[model samples]
Target: MRTLPIFIILLGIITINSCSKDPETDSDDQTKMFTDNDVLEEIRNNTLFFYQGDTATLSAAGNSPHGTFKLLFNQTALDALGADGKLAAGDTFPTGSLVVKDVIRNGNTSFYAAMWKQPSAENANEDWLWYEAFLDGSLLVSIDAKGNGCIGCHRANTNRDFVNSFDLH
Candidate 1:
Protein backbone atom coordinates (compact mmCIF):
# COMPACT_ATOMS: atom_id res chain seq x y z
CA MET A 1 0.00 0.00 0.00
CA ARG A 2 2.80 2.43 0.86
CA THR A 3 4.46 2.03 -2.56
CA LEU A 4 1.17 2.05 -4.55
CA PRO A 5 0.75 5.84 -4.35
CA ILE A 6 4.25 6.51 -5.79
CA PHE A 7 3.59 4.18 -8.72
CA ILE A 8 0.36 5.93 -9.45
CA ILE A 9 2.10 9.33 -9.38
CA LEU A 10 4.74 8.13 -11.80
CA LEU A 11 2.11 6.80 -14.21
CA GLY A 12 0.24 10.04 -14.04
CA ILE A 13 3.38 12.04 -14.82
CA ILE A 14 4.15 9.93 -17.87
CA THR A 15 0.62 10.20 -19.15
CA ILE A 16 0.61 13.97 -18.76
CA ASN A 17 3.94 14.30 -20.53
CA SER A 18 2.82 12.16 -23.44
CA CYS A 19 -0.44 14.01 -23.78
CA SER A 20 1.30 17.39 -23.70
CA LYS A 21 3.22 16.71 -26.92
CA ASP A 22 0.28 15.48 -28.95
CA PRO A 23 -0.62 18.19 -31.43
CA GLU A 24 -4.17 16.98 -31.96
CA THR A 25 -4.97 16.71 -28.29
CA ASP A 26 -2.97 19.64 -27.00
CA SER A 27 -4.91 22.79 -26.24
CA ASP A 28 -2.01 25.09 -27.15
CA ASP A 29 -1.74 24.55 -30.87
CA GLN A 30 1.42 25.34 -32.69
CA THR A 31 0.55 27.59 -35.60
CA LYS A 32 1.49 26.21 -38.99
CA MET A 33 4.17 28.15 -40.83
CA PHE A 34 3.65 29.11 -44.47
CA THR A 35 5.21 31.75 -46.68
CA ASP A 36 4.05 33.28 -49.95
CA ASN A 37 6.50 31.05 -51.81
CA ASP A 38 5.22 28.04 -49.89
CA VAL A 39 1.68 28.97 -50.82
CA LEU A 40 2.74 29.46 -54.45
CA GLU A 41 4.59 26.16 -54.54
CA GLU A 42 1.77 24.22 -52.95
CA ILE A 43 -0.65 25.75 -55.44
CA ARG A 44 1.60 24.82 -58.32
CA ASN A 45 2.33 21.27 -57.20
CA ASN A 46 -1.15 20.36 -56.00
CA THR A 47 -3.47 22.24 -58.36
CA LEU A 48 -4.69 20.50 -61.49
CA PHE A 49 -3.12 22.27 -64.47
CA PHE A 50 -5.75 23.02 -67.11
CA TYR A 51 -5.73 24.40 -70.66
CA GLN A 52 -8.32 26.44 -72.53
CA GLY A 53 -10.77 24.94 -75.04
CA ASP A 54 -14.50 24.80 -75.70
CA THR A 55 -14.07 22.28 -72.88
CA ALA A 56 -11.41 22.54 -70.18
CA THR A 57 -9.14 19.50 -69.92
CA LEU A 58 -6.68 17.99 -67.43
CA SER A 59 -3.68 18.63 -69.68
CA ALA A 60 -1.61 21.83 -69.54
CA ALA A 61 -1.88 22.49 -73.25
CA GLY A 62 -4.77 23.11 -75.62
CA ASN A 63 -6.59 26.30 -76.54
CA SER A 64 -4.68 27.76 -73.65
CA PRO A 65 -1.39 28.15 -75.47
CA HIS A 66 -0.13 30.24 -72.56
CA GLY A 67 -1.44 27.66 -70.03
CA THR A 68 -4.22 27.92 -67.46
CA PHE A 69 -4.82 27.32 -63.74
CA LYS A 70 -7.91 26.66 -61.64
CA LEU A 71 -9.05 27.58 -58.12
CA LEU A 72 -11.97 26.98 -55.78
CA PHE A 73 -14.98 29.30 -55.33
CA ASN A 74 -15.47 30.70 -51.85
CA GLN A 75 -15.87 33.96 -49.94
CA THR A 76 -12.21 34.97 -50.07
CA ALA A 77 -12.10 35.30 -53.85
CA LEU A 78 -15.44 37.07 -53.95
CA ASP A 79 -14.49 39.49 -51.22
CA ALA A 80 -11.05 40.26 -52.59
CA LEU A 81 -12.27 40.76 -56.11
CA GLY A 82 -15.37 42.52 -54.92
CA ALA A 83 -13.30 44.88 -52.80
CA ASP A 84 -10.84 45.67 -55.58
CA GLY A 85 -12.16 45.99 -59.09
CA LYS A 86 -8.77 44.88 -60.43
CA LEU A 87 -5.91 42.45 -59.79
CA ALA A 88 -2.55 41.82 -61.47
CA ALA A 89 -2.28 38.81 -63.80
CA GLY A 90 1.42 38.55 -64.36
CA ASP A 91 1.98 39.96 -67.89
CA THR A 92 -1.42 39.09 -69.43
CA PHE A 93 -5.03 38.11 -68.82
CA PRO A 94 -6.80 34.72 -68.18
CA THR A 95 -4.52 34.49 -65.13
CA GLY A 96 -5.61 37.12 -62.63
CA SER A 97 -4.57 35.50 -59.34
CA LEU A 98 -0.83 35.65 -59.89
CA VAL A 99 -0.34 39.24 -58.93
CA VAL A 100 -4.05 39.34 -58.18
CA LYS A 101 -5.85 38.41 -54.96
CA ASP A 102 -8.57 35.90 -55.90
CA VAL A 103 -9.27 33.43 -53.15
CA ILE A 104 -11.74 30.96 -51.66
CA ARG A 105 -12.38 29.34 -48.34
CA ASN A 106 -12.31 25.59 -47.71
CA GLY A 107 -12.86 24.69 -44.10
CA ASN A 108 -9.97 26.18 -42.17
CA THR A 109 -7.76 26.63 -45.21
CA SER A 110 -7.77 29.30 -47.90
CA PHE A 111 -7.02 28.80 -51.59
CA TYR A 112 -5.38 31.43 -53.82
CA ALA A 113 -4.47 30.85 -57.48
CA ALA A 114 -3.81 32.57 -60.85
CA MET A 115 -2.56 31.85 -64.36
CA TRP A 116 -0.81 33.66 -67.24
CA LYS A 117 -1.15 33.94 -71.04
CA GLN A 118 -4.87 34.13 -71.63
CA PRO A 119 -6.03 32.01 -74.61
CA SER A 120 -6.86 34.26 -77.55
CA ALA A 121 -10.14 32.56 -78.36
CA GLU A 122 -11.34 33.25 -74.86
CA ASN A 123 -9.98 36.75 -74.29
CA ALA A 124 -6.98 38.98 -74.86
CA ASN A 125 -5.72 38.33 -71.30
CA GLU A 126 -5.14 35.18 -69.35
CA ASP A 127 -7.55 33.90 -66.70
CA TRP A 128 -6.67 33.30 -63.06
CA LEU A 129 -8.94 32.26 -60.21
CA TRP A 130 -8.68 31.17 -56.56
CA TYR A 131 -10.52 30.12 -53.37
CA GLU A 132 -8.87 31.01 -50.10
CA ALA A 133 -9.70 31.17 -46.37
CA PHE A 134 -9.45 34.57 -44.77
CA LEU A 135 -8.33 33.33 -41.36
CA ASP A 136 -6.75 36.47 -40.13
CA GLY A 137 -2.95 36.20 -40.71
CA SER A 138 -2.58 32.63 -39.58
CA LEU A 139 -1.22 29.75 -41.70
CA LEU A 140 -3.46 26.87 -42.79
CA VAL A 141 -3.45 23.97 -45.22
CA SER A 142 -5.28 24.74 -48.49
CA ILE A 143 -6.13 21.91 -50.84
CA ASP A 144 -6.39 22.72 -54.56
CA ALA A 145 -9.67 21.21 -55.67
CA LYS A 146 -9.69 22.87 -59.07
CA GLY A 147 -12.76 21.10 -60.37
CA ASN A 148 -15.29 21.71 -63.18
CA GLY A 149 -16.91 24.62 -61.39
CA CYS A 150 -13.67 26.53 -61.74
CA ILE A 151 -13.57 26.03 -65.49
CA GLY A 152 -17.29 26.65 -65.81
CA CYS A 153 -17.04 30.01 -64.08
CA HIS A 154 -14.12 31.10 -66.21
CA ARG A 155 -16.01 29.88 -69.24
CA ALA A 156 -18.66 32.45 -68.45
CA ASN A 157 -15.93 35.08 -68.78
CA THR A 158 -15.08 33.95 -72.30
CA ASN A 159 -16.46 37.21 -73.61
CA ARG A 160 -14.00 40.06 -74.17
CA ASP A 161 -15.52 42.21 -71.44
CA PHE A 162 -15.84 39.39 -68.91
CA VAL A 163 -15.32 40.33 -65.28
CA ASN A 164 -12.18 38.16 -65.30
CA SER A 165 -10.24 41.02 -66.80
CA PHE A 166 -9.23 43.32 -63.96
CA ASP A 167 -6.72 45.24 -66.14
CA LEU A 168 -4.06 44.87 -63.42
CA HIS A 169 -1.44 43.93 -66.03
Candidate 2:
Protein backbone atom coordinates (compact mmCIF):
# COMPACT_ATOMS: atom_id res chain seq x y z
CA MET A 1 0.00 0.00 0.00
CA ARG A 2 2.86 2.45 0.88
CA THR A 3 4.68 1.48 -2.33
CA LEU A 4 1.60 2.33 -4.38
CA PRO A 5 1.53 5.89 -2.91
CA ILE A 6 5.29 6.32 -3.38
CA PHE A 7 5.10 5.18 -7.05
CA ILE A 8 2.28 7.60 -7.75
CA ILE A 9 4.26 10.43 -6.12
CA LEU A 10 7.32 9.55 -8.20
CA LEU A 11 5.26 9.59 -11.39
CA GLY A 12 3.75 12.98 -10.45
CA ILE A 13 7.20 14.39 -9.73
CA ILE A 14 8.46 13.14 -13.10
CA THR A 15 5.50 14.72 -14.88
CA ILE A 16 6.03 18.04 -13.17
CA ASN A 17 9.72 18.05 -13.96
CA SER A 18 9.05 17.20 -17.60
CA CYS A 19 6.51 20.01 -17.89
CA SER A 20 8.94 22.67 -16.61
CA LYS A 21 10.46 24.94 -19.23
CA ASP A 22 14.16 24.62 -19.94
CA PRO A 23 15.97 27.60 -21.37
CA GLU A 24 18.22 25.44 -23.53
CA THR A 25 15.27 23.79 -25.24
CA ASP A 26 13.33 27.02 -25.71
CA SER A 27 14.68 28.06 -29.13
CA ASP A 28 11.44 29.74 -30.21
CA ASP A 29 11.87 32.47 -27.60
CA GLN A 30 15.57 32.78 -28.34
CA THR A 31 14.91 33.41 -32.02
CA LYS A 32 12.58 36.27 -31.14
CA MET A 33 15.57 38.22 -29.83
CA PHE A 34 16.37 39.27 -33.40
CA THR A 35 12.94 40.67 -34.22
CA ASP A 36 12.48 43.84 -36.27
CA ASN A 37 12.85 46.36 -33.46
CA ASP A 38 16.07 44.82 -32.23
CA VAL A 39 17.59 45.02 -35.69
CA LEU A 40 16.51 48.65 -36.12
CA GLU A 41 18.19 49.69 -32.91
CA GLU A 42 21.44 48.05 -33.97
CA ILE A 43 21.37 49.81 -37.35
CA ARG A 44 20.56 53.22 -35.88
CA ASN A 45 23.31 52.96 -33.30
CA ASN A 46 26.05 51.40 -35.43
CA THR A 47 25.91 52.71 -39.01
CA LEU A 48 28.26 55.68 -39.50
CA PHE A 49 28.53 56.93 -43.12
CA PHE A 50 25.75 57.55 -45.61
CA TYR A 51 26.38 57.54 -49.36
CA GLN A 52 24.86 60.64 -50.92
CA GLY A 53 26.27 60.50 -54.43
CA ASP A 54 24.01 58.80 -56.97
CA THR A 55 21.18 56.45 -56.15
CA ALA A 56 20.68 53.11 -57.86
CA THR A 57 17.42 53.14 -59.81
CA LEU A 58 15.63 49.82 -59.72
CA SER A 59 13.81 48.79 -62.88
CA ALA A 60 10.05 49.32 -62.94
CA ALA A 61 9.60 46.37 -65.33
CA GLY A 62 10.75 43.80 -62.80
CA ASN A 63 8.39 43.51 -59.83
CA SER A 64 7.75 47.27 -60.23
CA PRO A 65 10.50 47.99 -57.80
CA HIS A 66 10.14 51.67 -56.96
CA GLY A 67 12.72 52.87 -54.54
CA THR A 68 15.69 55.23 -54.50
CA PHE A 69 18.32 53.54 -52.43
CA LYS A 70 21.11 55.07 -50.38
CA LEU A 71 24.10 53.26 -49.07
CA LEU A 72 25.52 53.50 -45.57
CA PHE A 73 28.75 52.05 -44.34
CA ASN A 74 29.94 51.58 -40.83
CA GLN A 75 33.26 53.18 -39.95
CA THR A 76 35.12 49.91 -40.20
CA ALA A 77 33.81 49.29 -43.69
CA LEU A 78 34.58 52.86 -44.82
CA ASP A 79 38.13 52.51 -43.56
CA ALA A 80 38.41 49.27 -45.47
CA LEU A 81 37.29 51.06 -48.65
CA GLY A 82 40.18 53.52 -48.04
CA ALA A 83 41.18 56.77 -49.83
CA ASP A 84 41.61 55.34 -53.32
CA GLY A 85 37.86 54.89 -53.00
CA LYS A 86 36.80 51.67 -54.70
CA LEU A 87 36.39 48.12 -53.53
CA ALA A 88 38.30 45.87 -55.93
CA ALA A 89 37.58 42.29 -56.82
CA GLY A 90 40.48 41.04 -54.79
CA ASP A 91 39.98 43.35 -51.83
CA THR A 92 38.49 41.65 -48.82
CA PHE A 93 36.58 43.59 -46.20
CA PRO A 94 37.70 42.95 -42.67
CA THR A 95 35.48 41.08 -40.27
CA GLY A 96 33.01 43.30 -38.36
CA SER A 97 32.56 45.55 -41.44
CA LEU A 98 28.96 46.52 -42.17
CA VAL A 99 27.23 48.07 -45.18
CA VAL A 100 23.60 49.13 -45.33
CA LYS A 101 21.20 50.16 -48.05
CA ASP A 102 18.33 52.45 -47.18
CA VAL A 103 15.47 52.40 -49.62
CA ILE A 104 13.18 55.39 -50.07
CA ARG A 105 9.93 55.25 -51.99
CA ASN A 106 7.60 58.22 -52.50
CA GLY A 107 10.00 60.32 -50.43
CA ASN A 108 9.53 58.11 -47.42
CA THR A 109 12.22 55.74 -46.20
CA SER A 110 10.92 52.26 -46.90
CA PHE A 111 13.37 49.59 -45.89
CA TYR A 112 16.97 48.76 -45.26
CA ALA A 113 19.19 45.96 -46.52
CA ALA A 114 22.48 45.28 -44.84
CA MET A 115 25.48 43.04 -45.16
CA TRP A 116 27.78 42.29 -42.31
CA LYS A 117 31.21 40.73 -42.69
CA GLN A 118 31.59 37.94 -40.20
CA PRO A 119 34.31 35.89 -41.78
CA SER A 120 35.73 32.78 -40.26
CA ALA A 121 38.16 30.31 -41.72
CA GLU A 122 35.49 27.64 -41.63
CA ASN A 123 33.11 29.72 -43.73
CA ALA A 124 35.56 31.85 -45.70
CA ASN A 125 33.82 31.00 -48.97
CA GLU A 126 30.76 32.99 -47.94
CA ASP A 127 31.68 35.42 -45.21
CA TRP A 128 28.93 37.97 -45.21
CA LEU A 129 25.63 37.84 -43.34
CA TRP A 130 22.62 39.52 -44.94
CA TYR A 131 19.81 41.40 -43.21
CA GLU A 132 16.69 43.23 -44.36
CA ALA A 133 14.42 45.35 -42.24
CA PHE A 134 11.55 47.79 -42.60
CA LEU A 135 12.18 51.57 -42.48
CA ASP A 136 11.14 51.56 -38.86
CA GLY A 137 14.01 49.12 -38.32
CA SER A 138 11.88 46.05 -37.95
CA LEU A 139 13.73 43.02 -39.18
CA LEU A 140 12.19 41.42 -42.22
CA VAL A 141 14.87 38.92 -43.01
CA SER A 142 18.16 37.82 -41.58
CA ILE A 143 20.37 35.31 -43.35
CA ASP A 144 23.49 33.98 -41.80
CA ALA A 145 26.75 33.47 -43.72
CA LYS A 146 25.60 30.18 -45.19
CA GLY A 147 22.42 31.68 -46.63
CA ASN A 148 21.73 31.08 -50.32
CA GLY A 149 19.83 34.02 -51.78
CA CYS A 150 22.16 36.79 -50.67
CA ILE A 151 25.26 34.79 -51.52
CA GLY A 152 23.89 33.92 -54.94
CA CYS A 153 23.24 37.54 -55.85
CA HIS A 154 26.56 38.67 -54.42
CA ARG A 155 28.51 35.94 -56.16
CA ALA A 156 27.94 37.75 -59.44
CA ASN A 157 29.93 40.66 -58.01
CA THR A 158 32.92 38.59 -57.04
CA ASN A 159 35.10 40.95 -59.02
CA ARG A 160 34.04 43.74 -56.69
CA ASP A 161 34.66 41.77 -53.54
CA PHE A 162 31.09 40.45 -53.76
CA VAL A 163 29.73 44.00 -53.45
CA ASN A 164 27.68 45.39 -56.33
CA SER A 165 28.29 49.06 -55.38
CA PHE A 166 31.97 49.37 -56.10
CA ASP A 167 31.48 52.87 -57.52
CA LEU A 168 29.61 54.22 -54.48
CA HIS A 169 32.66 56.13 -53.26
Candidate 3:
Protein backbone atom coordinates (compact mmCIF):
# COMPACT_ATOMS: atom_id res chain seq x y z
CA MET A 1 0.00 0.00 0.00
CA ARG A 2 1.82 3.18 1.23
CA THR A 3 5.06 1.14 1.68
CA LEU A 4 5.24 0.37 -2.06
CA PRO A 5 5.03 4.09 -3.03
CA ILE A 6 7.71 5.06 -0.44
CA PHE A 7 10.10 2.41 -1.80
CA ILE A 8 9.52 3.66 -5.38
CA ILE A 9 10.28 7.29 -4.37
CA LEU A 10 13.51 6.27 -2.61
CA LEU A 11 14.58 4.26 -5.63
CA GLY A 12 13.95 7.21 -7.96
CA ILE A 13 16.00 9.57 -5.72
CA ILE A 14 18.94 7.09 -5.68
CA THR A 15 18.81 6.78 -9.49
CA ILE A 16 18.85 10.59 -9.97
CA ASN A 17 21.73 11.01 -7.52
CA SER A 18 23.81 8.42 -9.35
CA CYS A 19 23.19 10.11 -12.76
CA SER A 20 24.06 13.71 -11.64
CA LYS A 21 27.52 15.27 -11.80
CA ASP A 22 29.31 16.73 -8.76
CA PRO A 23 29.76 20.47 -9.41
CA GLU A 24 32.80 20.96 -7.15
CA THR A 25 34.99 18.42 -8.98
CA ASP A 26 33.77 19.57 -12.43
CA SER A 27 35.77 22.86 -12.18
CA ASP A 28 38.97 20.95 -13.07
CA ASP A 29 37.74 20.64 -16.70
CA GLN A 30 37.59 24.46 -17.08
CA THR A 31 40.46 26.40 -18.62
CA LYS A 32 42.89 28.07 -16.22
CA MET A 33 42.75 31.87 -15.94
CA PHE A 34 46.00 33.84 -16.14
CA THR A 35 47.43 37.34 -15.79
CA ASP A 36 49.93 38.76 -18.31
CA ASN A 37 53.46 38.19 -16.99
CA ASP A 38 54.85 40.89 -19.31
CA VAL A 39 52.89 43.58 -17.53
CA LEU A 40 54.21 42.42 -14.18
CA GLU A 41 57.74 42.30 -15.55
CA GLU A 42 57.36 45.80 -16.95
CA ILE A 43 56.16 47.04 -13.59
CA ARG A 44 59.09 45.40 -11.88
CA ASN A 45 61.80 46.55 -14.27
CA ASN A 46 60.35 49.86 -15.40
CA THR A 47 58.32 51.07 -12.44
CA LEU A 48 59.49 54.36 -10.98
CA PHE A 49 59.66 52.82 -7.53
CA PHE A 50 59.08 49.46 -5.85
CA TYR A 51 58.37 48.17 -2.36
CA GLN A 52 61.77 46.47 -2.32
CA GLY A 53 63.49 49.88 -2.81
CA ASP A 54 64.25 49.52 -6.51
CA THR A 55 64.16 52.69 -8.61
CA ALA A 56 63.70 53.49 -12.29
CA THR A 57 63.82 56.70 -14.27
CA LEU A 58 60.80 56.49 -16.56
CA SER A 59 61.09 57.44 -20.22
CA ALA A 60 58.55 59.78 -21.82
CA ALA A 61 56.73 56.82 -23.40
CA GLY A 62 56.91 54.93 -20.11
CA ASN A 63 54.77 57.73 -18.71
CA SER A 64 52.90 57.42 -21.97
CA PRO A 65 50.86 59.87 -24.12
CA HIS A 66 49.25 61.31 -20.93
CA GLY A 67 52.02 61.90 -18.34
CA THR A 68 54.14 60.34 -15.62
CA PHE A 69 53.62 59.89 -11.89
CA LYS A 70 55.82 58.94 -8.95
CA LEU A 71 55.57 57.55 -5.43
CA LEU A 72 57.35 58.19 -2.09
CA PHE A 73 56.49 55.61 0.53
CA ASN A 74 56.70 55.82 4.34
CA GLN A 75 55.57 53.39 7.01
CA THR A 76 53.16 55.86 8.66
CA ALA A 77 51.02 56.19 5.53
CA LEU A 78 51.25 52.50 4.74
CA ASP A 79 49.84 51.73 8.17
CA ALA A 80 47.11 54.32 7.73
CA LEU A 81 45.94 52.44 4.65
CA GLY A 82 45.41 49.56 7.10
CA ALA A 83 44.57 46.22 5.48
CA ASP A 84 42.10 48.46 3.57
CA GLY A 85 41.95 52.28 3.06
CA LYS A 86 40.65 52.86 6.58
CA LEU A 87 42.79 54.63 9.14
CA ALA A 88 43.30 53.55 12.72
CA ALA A 89 43.92 55.75 15.76
CA GLY A 90 46.96 58.02 16.03
CA ASP A 91 47.76 57.54 12.36
CA THR A 92 49.87 60.15 10.57
CA PHE A 93 51.00 59.87 6.94
CA PRO A 94 53.73 61.68 5.05
CA THR A 95 52.62 63.63 2.00
CA GLY A 96 54.60 62.87 -1.12
CA SER A 97 54.95 65.11 -4.17
CA LEU A 98 53.67 64.28 -7.66
CA VAL A 99 54.89 65.91 -10.84
CA VAL A 100 53.13 65.35 -14.13
CA LYS A 101 53.83 66.70 -17.60
CA ASP A 102 50.18 66.86 -18.55
CA VAL A 103 49.08 66.69 -22.17
CA ILE A 104 46.29 68.95 -23.33
CA ARG A 105 44.91 69.45 -26.82
CA ASN A 106 42.70 71.92 -28.62
CA GLY A 107 41.91 70.78 -32.18
CA ASN A 108 45.20 70.69 -34.09
CA THR A 109 47.23 72.41 -31.35
CA SER A 110 48.87 70.29 -28.65
CA PHE A 111 51.02 71.40 -25.75
CA TYR A 112 52.45 70.07 -22.51
CA ALA A 113 53.35 71.52 -19.12
CA ALA A 114 54.18 70.39 -15.61
CA MET A 115 51.51 69.84 -12.95
CA TRP A 116 52.43 69.07 -9.35
CA LYS A 117 50.85 68.02 -6.07
CA GLN A 118 47.17 68.46 -6.87
CA PRO A 119 46.92 65.41 -4.63
CA SER A 120 49.72 64.02 -2.51
CA ALA A 121 50.26 61.10 -0.11
CA GLU A 122 53.07 58.74 0.84
CA ASN A 123 51.29 55.44 0.26
CA ALA A 124 51.81 53.82 -3.14
CA ASN A 125 48.84 51.47 -3.03
CA GLU A 126 46.60 54.14 -1.54
CA ASP A 127 47.45 57.37 -3.40
CA TRP A 128 49.49 56.57 -6.49
CA LEU A 129 47.64 53.59 -7.91
CA TRP A 130 48.76 53.04 -11.50
CA TYR A 131 46.75 53.39 -14.70
CA GLU A 132 47.19 53.92 -18.45
CA ALA A 133 45.66 56.82 -20.37
CA PHE A 134 46.26 59.31 -23.20
CA LEU A 135 45.46 62.83 -24.47
CA ASP A 136 47.06 65.58 -26.53
CA GLY A 137 49.28 68.07 -24.65
CA SER A 138 46.84 70.75 -23.43
CA LEU A 139 43.79 69.38 -21.58
CA LEU A 140 44.84 66.74 -19.06
CA VAL A 141 42.20 64.52 -17.52
CA SER A 142 43.20 61.65 -15.24
CA ILE A 143 41.50 58.61 -16.72
CA ASP A 144 42.72 56.75 -13.67
CA ALA A 145 41.40 58.92 -10.82
CA LYS A 146 38.11 59.38 -12.68
CA GLY A 147 36.96 56.09 -11.17
CA ASN A 148 38.00 55.94 -7.50
CA GLY A 149 35.40 53.37 -6.51
CA CYS A 150 36.56 51.00 -9.22
CA ILE A 151 39.74 50.11 -7.28
CA GLY A 152 38.39 50.55 -3.77
CA CYS A 153 35.41 48.31 -4.52
CA HIS A 154 37.48 45.61 -6.12
CA ARG A 155 39.83 45.80 -3.14
CA ALA A 156 37.01 44.66 -0.90
CA ASN A 157 38.65 41.25 -1.04
CA THR A 158 41.33 41.98 1.57
CA ASN A 159 41.40 38.36 2.63
CA ARG A 160 42.88 37.52 -0.77
CA ASP A 161 46.18 39.21 0.25
CA PHE A 162 45.14 42.87 -0.20
CA VAL A 163 45.44 42.33 -3.99
CA ASN A 164 46.64 45.88 -4.58
CA SER A 165 49.28 44.33 -6.78
CA PHE A 166 48.56 41.57 -9.27
CA ASP A 167 50.39 38.21 -9.33
CA LEU A 168 52.24 36.39 -12.19
CA HIS A 169 55.61 37.98 -12.14
lDDT of each: 0.36, 0.63, 0.33
lDDT for each residue of candidate 1 in 130-153, tens digit (9 for 90 to 100): 233333433222323322334554
> Candidate 3 — what's its lDDT?
0.33
- Per-model TM-score, in order, reads 0.28, 0.61, 0.21
- Write candidate 3's Cα lDDT for 45-103 as tens digits: 43232223334322234213332322223343334344533333333233332222223
- Tell me the tens digit of each residue's lDDT in model 2 across 14-121: 987886666667655443222334435657888467543335544223222324666777878888775555565688888777777777777656888777675542
List candidate 3 segments past 4 Å from native: 1-15, 18-21, 26-53, 70-169
Q: What's model 3's TM-score?
A: 0.21
Q: Rank the candidates by TM-score, best first.
A: 2, 1, 3
